[model samples]
Target: MNPWLPAAPCAPGTCAAHTGRTRLRPVAAALLLAGCAWVLAGALGAPFLPLFGPTRRERLIRRWSYGAVRAFGVRVRVTGAPVPPAGTPGTLVVANHISWLDIPLVAAVLPGRMLAKREIRQWPVLGPLAARGGTLFVDRDRLRALPATVRALAAAMRGGSRVVVFPEGTTWCGRGPGGRFGPAAFQAAIDADATVLPVRIGYRVTGHGAAAPAERHAPAGAAAFVGDDPLPASLWRVVRAAGLTAELHVLQPVPAGALPDRRALARRAQRAVASESANRSPESVHH
Candidate 1:
């Protein structure tokens, strides 16, 4: 295994058990169709995204992202001020990785060029869409390519694009300690003198007011797509889940140069995201 590859202990058998109420098969099928159609629509329309100005493009991206998650039967509750608008001298949006749903959830609020693994560029439907949407792909297995990836990220940010990255380098179960934020992406922010916006994503299964002991821990895991879990299985689980709410906690933005180094910057953003663990109560407000 490459030393740079990040892994999480969370797995389908151990961490992705869905104990909450699930939707009927028919309902889940309908939701699955809608979600897939919405995603396809986005892919088909991606080529024209550059025709619109920044503000309008941002609006379209946000609206499409919202619809995508809603089609998957996931309700999103956003907190904190909206992300800094485009043309703000570039912003690096960092968040924890959980489910595949996290992609649309974050884009709904802060639509930007995503920093993704290079292997995604070869995936079936999402590959072309990601490329058209200007995703930055980094080859994680090649340790020597680190500097080039950082340069590309810096160039994108310098061009005034908000680049979204999951700096932990892998997905987690979102119940315990998330992996540490790698410092490579933070170096791009430092190089471009861009602001770092940290967002925390949490999920909870609703309609479980009086849940049993086994079902109590079903919130985050219901939507977790960690380890070697297949994509279709995770999607089916999400569509069938009852009243799954995805919470986006948009924490304060750390101003450019606030931290002296990439490690310091990574630590600051990680701390902001980790703070959301304290707000894990079920009755948290939504906006």
Candidate 2:
């Protein structure tokens, strides 16, 4: 009955009833853990910064991300292979941007420093966490900032750490392609001679351990942070929605060394994500 809740579920029989039930407890748990996580991250992370490496803070972040995803009551099923565990050198991860949840989802799956928009670094609790967790902030509005950002990212990649980047620049509804990826970040991998890992993020509805294909790769009633949708409103929608699932497909890695140019690398990563995204549409399935 919450105003933020979507209309009744579309599935037939008991599936509809099950889908209509909102999981408020998970949301509550997530909120509580989020508060604790941030507080601990700031309080504990700062003191140890001089002693332990960045991985300590990253580990804490990863734990919180896993908890947050569970709190959403959504199951994340990962397909394809992982891109060599956390320490592999010269690894650059790129994925399609969906909901703000994509942040935690990626953190939960691939623990690494994220290339986030400058705005995210200014958010409330997230700002502190991102700062402590080693996020690379970019001012998308400043053309002059691109080269420096690219150079910094290149240095980070070459230092033997995984860097996750959303090449789509901005978020989009999973119903279609997320637009062309900018070649600037790809230049980082090219410069560092890193392995480009293309990842596709999609949504689905699950019931009785089976998934129903989403409309435009987004499950019916799935949460999407697109357009002018406010963060609170999106969170409300997510908590109210039922049977939601996040599918993270780690597509094959493209070697940046073999690419002719940064443009070629960008196009290849975009194609991998876009093709996988299209594959999740209704037409891809057989009757």
Candidate 3:
């Protein structure tokens, strides 16, 4: 149960296969050591540092995250880079969820206030820091409070602060029974007629060991995700195993004005994201 070893191939298909790391292990380790220490200094210990400017703080957090991924020896290869013009009104950036590392990966690429579940706000070291990042926390089951969260997001957009939301509501390694996406989830945008940009996240797995998913009693891989977890517990094994290459691909952007109703727009954008996603389920990957 080594945190550095890669994930063991078990109970899994080719959805998001990932393996191999020796080549970049040292660099990844250095990034993590330096990046985590920097972010922790900024995030941990009560009150958090008084971030003078959101822009400056955003850069610090983002640089730390990108360093984290690279330090993990995880290569990110974005495709169809989303090039949204600057000075545009705050738009809603919607995307699908993949690994736990996803939050940092995408955020490193784009800076936008995130909409995350209330659970994330309770995380030990990262929780308080995320709150300071201006992320909107919500109790998913609180239908009554749902409106409030949506409104807050809308308000942020109106105020010129972009927002990112995962309407699917939960994470699934991007496979098997995708959590339902609330059709009206983007109602605020439709209400304000604001622009909604759909983003997609995918993890590419490679190599032999990358082909297995441990069983129910899979010797503590997922559970080993407590502290020092952005890099999965299985990372070291996966790295030592060999023959692996993972590439990240960011899809094209969809203009809100071009689509019809919010539902239709959501569906079209969903398809675009799924298509552009490299981790599409094995069965669907063939399509």
Candidate 4:
């Protein structure tokens, strides 16, 4: 009935805290502090800090990103510890998308350039860092832009910089569907003749169970999903709550050259990621 607590809705902060949705305050505070902490660190890291050069800077950024998220109770579990061909030789890394949280989680945890959406580079606090971290973005609406974007992505790979792309295109709530991605990124990797490695990220719930009217705490996956809207209002609600520790598993690398073709590679990638995770389902990668 109220703006803050409207009728049932999917987006955060529109439903009552007990409506099996995010409680406003915790979510809001978490988002606020997360932003501030990330921004402040980068601001201090400075564009010319020398200490934050491409390699060092990226690692530093990911570490801080992981820490900020940990404070929010969203533990990131990365499986398939990077299988860099030739022992750290440059390769293109692809994975399925779980949430917007995936970007920071991977960026902060993995060392490489990320194939991200052009829009994220415009976000507050995170945008600048992404651009500097060498993240490549594709504007789906602008098809012509693909050629240039792909070229840049290839250059990074050839230059010995590991680039990560989420062929899934967008984020998921990590419960419904695994995710879907376009074939363009894959084609680009093929064109570059870069080996593709698949990675899986799973966030497990350590506390609580299914929903109950009087059970006002949290559900199974609550530790990772509750009140995370990247909005000031919702992040505030998660800060004080204790979140579960997430698990990460790194799978072996999948080479494009070993597959029959690009399509086959994509299909096998889906099966590989879905094959042996304890609880998560199969994941599909976009081209």
Tens digits of per-residue lDDT for model 3, 1-287: 32422232223233233333243666545645654565576575325435336666556666766665555445454545544644457677777654556666766766678888787898776788789777889776666787887688778887887777877655555444344455555776766557777666654433345353221111212211222334444344233322222333445655666677767877876776666243432222110
Q: CA lDDT, every prediction?
A: 0.86, 0.70, 0.56, 0.56
List, residue by residue over 9-120, the lDDT tens digit for candidate 1: 8898888877777899999999999999999999999999999988898899999999999999998887665556556768999999988888889888888899998988
Query: Which portions of model 3 miss their true places by more than 4 Å?
Result: 1-39, 42-57, 85-87, 175-180, 206-248, 276-287
Candidate 1 stretches greater than 4 Å from native: 208-218, 276-287
TM-score of each: 0.93, 0.79, 0.68, 0.72
> Which number leads on lDDT?
1
Task: Evaluate residue 39 in candidate 1 and report its C-alpha lDDT on the 0 to 100 scale.
Answer: 93
The TM-score measured for candidate 3 stands at: 0.68
Of candidate 1, the 10-residue stretch with the lowest lDDT total is 278-287
User: What's the lDDT for residue 92 in model 2?
Assistant: 90
- Can you give the lDDT of residue 163 in candidate 4? 80
Q: Write the per-residue lDDT of candidate 4 for residues 1-287, one digit (tens) a residue.
A: 12322111233433213223443565647555765776667655646645545556655666776776665656555534443423365576676655455666665555577887677778876787767666677776676787888788777777777788877555443444354445566666676677777766555434346532223212224323323355443344434334433444456676666776667777767666555552342232210
Residue 22 CA error for candidate 2 (Å)?
4.0
Measured on C-alpha atoms, candidate 1 has an lDDT of 0.86
List ranges where model 2 is wrong by over 4 Å: 1-59, 209-221, 277-287
RMSD of each: 2.6, 8.0, 8.9, 7.9
TM-score of 1: 0.93
lDDT tens digits by residue: candidate 2, 1-287 = 22421222222222211234465766645754564565455545544554656666556666767666656566666666544665678889999877777887788777787999888887876677677777899877777788999999999998987899988776666655567788888999999999999888876665543334322243433456765556665665565666677777777888998889999889988998888443443322101
